[model samples]
Target chain A: MNPQFIMDGLVAGAMIGLGAIGVTLTYSILRFANFAHGEFLSWGAYLALAVSGALGFLATGLTRPIAPFSFGWSLPLALVIAIFLTGLLALVLDAVLFARLRSRGSAVIILVMASFGASLALRSLLEFLFTSKPAYYTKALQIAVRLGGGLRATPDQLLSLGVTVVVVVVIHLLLTRTEIGRSMRAVSENPALAGIAGIDVRRVIRFVWFIGAGLACIAGTMTGLLVQIRPYLGHDLLLPLFSAAILGGIGSVPGAMIAGLIVGLSEAGAVQLVGAEWRSAVSFVILVLVLLLRPRGLFGRPA
Target chain B: MTGASPIPAAGAPALETRGLVAGYEPDLPIVRGVDLSVASGELLVLLGPNGAGKSTLVKAIAGVVPIHAGTVSIGGRDITALPAHRKIGAGLAFVPQTENIFATLSIQENLQIAAAVLPKARRAERIAAMYAQFPDLAVKPARLAGSLSGGQRQMLAIARALMVDPPVLILDEPSAGLSPKIVADVFSMLTEINRAGVTVVLVEQNVKAALAIASRAIILVEGRIGHEGAAQDLLDDPILARLYLGTGQAMEARRP
Candidate 1:
């Protein structure tokens, strides 16, 4: 097994892990699998692409890659724009579709179907606007920095890994240390009791959408930085993301992150063993094996 | 305990339902033309057979079930049209018979969620007050509500309700499925709470125990009030007890 191949797997695994956290959070809190979550990733990436393109048009001189870790107009600025835009898009989607359905007492399965419809609409919208062409943010890809043991990683991959860690940590703190987070847990456990307890269930639900969608956006944009951006980028990653969430246990954030890493590394290793053709099948295999054996996944609490 | 001075009528009733009619399905009222009240600082136990709409009546009052007819007022304010949260905001607390606690949350967190309607600055103090009231809860404040025994969970449920400091607390069979000792402890707590001037409306199948703590009692047959009077009067009267409280055969005989 080449160490470089392992590094490749780890980098990819990190991105999947980040995406999986959002899926798991939404699933646990909303009690539904949001099929449209994938669109947020695509949306986030496109948001970054659009912003970067607009800035580029303003002044070709401004289009120069910023110093330190460059992708033109500073990575931080680009990420902030991407996250905000993606978060806003998620909120709008909820307001327009999911929220109304929820009020009408729509079943969970109906909500799931609505998410599918939403995904199709968002995906098509992206395709119509951006075309099917693959795009990149930076003209110059950063040189790979080699670590010992035949492993090499680019600065973007390193930055993504760092970002994933920060996001996961912040989420962990939010869930454990904050009032809204506690309310979220309460609502997830028993919504009626939470309502009687005076928790604004609707507000907590909105927050869940924002956080889940926002994370998906970050994951989507990061993946774009690592690879090429396309409208189907998130769709392609959806199965793997879902697998990560299920593997971690539906509502467990830490479980989702760990499961995501497992899926990432496993897919990476599968490619090494069976070639790239088998890469897509890895998540399915893990999902099936877990469902057959554990059913609860690695960290899922018994229902 | 009949005619035990009435305690000078202690302000208006905490909850009053006049000709209330409610049910899950439209055109089939589970609670039919029921009129009842629980005076402030009083404990009123509502007893009935399994399908007699005891739970439905309270649910309607709490705004959990839609009232098809009549009015529900809390402290002289008409709240028949209020939603569940608004009803809670109006100082009405309901502890359901089952799934009453947020199982995954800690005892402290459960109380915190209950105090969510209160301003942030006051929640901590309210929680502290609850812990003080139930010092047993203080020892395991960090324990998950799910991990507690059935009795402890009931206590936590009651404690969560008290977090809002509601003037009226409604308990739907707080003693259900608990050991006799636990039931005794719960009744004692109810008495203590009543002494502290919180109005209590209790729905119980434990006729003897419920009557012992209740200042007033109502017996329901089908959806209508079969009997309403002093707790001790119903407890002592053989004909009334055998009719409405015992076997429920007499109560069923009078159903039509």
Candidate 2:
């Protein structure tokens, strides 16, 4: 086995894992697979692109890389802005569309369909604004340091993975050590009961969108840092993100993270063994196999 | 029974709902034109046959079901427009019949979520108090609520409702599907809890067991209140059961 594929998969998986966390959360709390979640990633990338460009005029030093990493100071600043903006966008969309439909007791199918429509509208808007061309943050390349066993990774990749770990740890603490997280879990388990218990269902929903979208924003920014940014950046990762989320268990956060790495490695392995063309198909195959075998996924409670 | 009620001599009713008309959808009111008042520190048992709108009535009072018409007051404070979640902060807690506890959350977390609105310093004391009240829950605080037995779940549900230390608690059929022994245990627990100064309004089908502890009882026949007042009074009058079960008009007409 070529160790390089494993290295590539680890980096790619870290990004997907971050994305899948949001997907799993929305599925768990909102009880629907939000097709428009991918667009939040798209929004994150584009918003960063725009912000980084504007900040270039404000501080010339911010545009420069912070040594050993591909990302510039402006990019980090851009990420913070992007996270809030994307989270706000998610809230606005929910307020305008999903929340009202939910209050009226719309079925899951209706919400899913509305999400599909939301995805199209969002994707089209991104395309209309950014055009079909690809964009970049720094256009500078970093030197890859050799780890061992003939494998090497750039500092950017390593940083992305480090950030992923920190984000995951923060989320774990939030869910386990805090009241809001406990309330979120309660709402996910049983909304009616949670409501009667005095957990504000609407507030929980709002917080979920904020956390989920904020995480996706970081993931998208990392992806843009690793590769080139495009309007379809999030569109390309949607299938694999869902695959990881489902394979991990619909509502389990840690399950989604581990599943993401597995999916990413599998896709990378497919690219090496079968062909790059077969890479995307690997996730769908895993999704089908999981559904056929362990339909509840690894960590999901049996429904 | 139809007019505005006189103010009770002892302070105010813990819970009062007047002309409450609500249901799941428009043009289909399950609980129509109902009035109820439970005095402070009283255990009011709401009895009726299945589909007599007993659960619907409690749900409307709890703010789970939207009231199409009428007012609901907790401790003389109008809370008809408050949503279900806000009711707890307003000194009202509701324990739903099914899915009353957070099934996926651990027993400890279920209590934590219930007391989320409390000050941080008081949360641990509140949880410890719940465990002390229900010794069964204390042993398995880490266990998922879904894994608990039917009787344990009911206890956990009641414990979760009590987490807020609410003055008024509304339970919708807490003992719906349990063994006779478990039913007796649950009713005894309710009696003890009510004694602890939490006014309770319980909707029950177990008439004999419910009346054993209830200070007052309201029997609903269809969407209307067919009988109300002292629990023993309703229990002693055999015609009340006939009226409640809607067995025959002859038994209802014979009521003195």
Candidate 3:
């Protein structure tokens, strides 16, 4: 296979790794797969697009793409805004919908169904607001930088990789070094005991929603930056992200990241070895193989 | 076994159940019109055979199970409407028979979480006090609660409950399945805790051990109080002992 293909695989893998981490964390902590997570990516992208467009209208000179990375200032500002907004949206969603259901002692399957409804509502809302037309943050494509072994990558790709690393590290520290993090882990392990221990299980659930949705926002924005921005951007990536989370073990953060990268690279490699048409099938194949052989995924502890 | 000294009239009972009728389901009341009180610094043990509703009574007081009728008041405030957390805040602590600790958390973390309502500045001091009281816990505070032996886990559970400094601590069969040695150690710990002015209510299958430490004792048969009196009185009464203690066979064998 071509080295360009390998580099392409790594770039794509990084995004998958980031998105999968969010999926895995949410699953482990919340005990359910959040189907609406994909909408967060679209929300983030639209936020950046809207902000950048407003900035461009304010200053004609700002129409030019930023140096090093070809996106506009509006994109970065929008990403920050999008992360907070999306995170808040997730909190509200939990409070208004999931929290009530959870309080009623709703079953996991019912919660999963609720998430599905949330996904549909969010997807349609994005479509109604943004239209179906594909948009871009920046028209200017950066000059590809050649590394070694005939591999070349755009500056945006490298920036996305750096962002992924930073976010993962920060999250790792938050999970391991902080008091709230310990409480979160405790709640995840046994909510009743945690409650009796005075850990405030509700507060932990709120925090999980914020972090998971915020990470989903970042993942959505990064993916948008690397490719085209569309309302269904997150939806398209959902399968691979879920696959990565499952493969990495549902609650293991590092496992999700590693699994994501693996999925990304595998898809890229599959495209290279077979054809682009087979790329979408890669995650499914891995899912089936892992489910059959390991059943618990790579990091899943035995039940 | 009839006349155990009633709670002194000066201060409030550590725990009081006023006509408590409780159960897991609404249609069935497992504890029917049970009224009891444990005074400050008392080790009151509830002894009964299986299906005697001992667990249900304790759970109702702890706000774990619903009380169909009656009130559970801690100190002076009525806590029948309060949730479990509020009940804990009101100075009541509960140690369940099983899965009482956050298994994945370290022993220190478990205790820290239990002290979550305390001020941040006082947490370290409170933890130190607990560790001093339970020195065996101090040795492996960093170990996961799940990895600890059964005896150590029970100690951690009790320690976790004590972190809130509750005046009344309830344990559901603290020695249900432990060996004789561990059971003795647990009973000794209960006595020490009671001696330190923490009111303790224990539910136990080991009739003799429970009676040995208890200041007051109550025996429940099919959810109603069958026998109530002093611990020593229950121990000495042959008919009461035979009926409730399952020592009928041994009592007959030793007949003069």
Best candidate per TM-score, number?
2
Model 1 chain B poorest ten-residue lDDT run: B1-10
Clashes of each: 0, 0, 0
How accurate locally, in lDDT, is each candidate?
0.85, 0.87, 0.83
What is the alpha-carbon lDDT for the whole of candidate 1?
0.85
lDDT of 1 by residue, A205-256 (tens): 8898889878988888888888989999999999999999999988788898
- Of candidate 1 chain A, the 10-residue stretch with the lowest lDDT total is A67-76
| Per-residue alpha-carbon lDDT of candidate 3 for residues B24-119, written as tens digits (9 for 90 to 100) | 778888899898888778899998777788998998888778889998877766779976766666678899999898787788888878777676
Cα displacement (Å) at residue B72, model 1: 2.6
Tens digits of lDDT, candidate 3, A107-156:
99999999999999989998999998888888887789988789899999
RMSD (Å) per prediction = 3.8, 4.1, 4.9
Once fitted onto the true fold, the runs of candidate 3 whose alpha carbons sit more than 4 angstroms away are A51-64, B1-10, B249-256
Best candidate (score: lDDT): 2
Q: Put down candidate 2 lDDT per residue, B1-256, tens digits, no spaces.
A: 1011223235778888899898998689989999888888899998877777899999988888878999999878888988888888888888888888888888988888876777788889888988998999999789998899999999999988888788888898888899989988988998888887878999987777888899999888777797888988877776776667433433333222
Q: By the DockQ metric, which is better: model 2 or model 3? A: 2
Candidate 1 segments exceeding 4 Å error: A59-62, A68-70, B1-11, B247-256
Please report, as a residue range, the 10-residue window in candidate 2 chain A with the lowest summed lDDT.
A63-72
Question: What's the CA error at residue A11 for candidate 3, in Å?
Answer: 2.7
lDDT value for model 2: 0.87
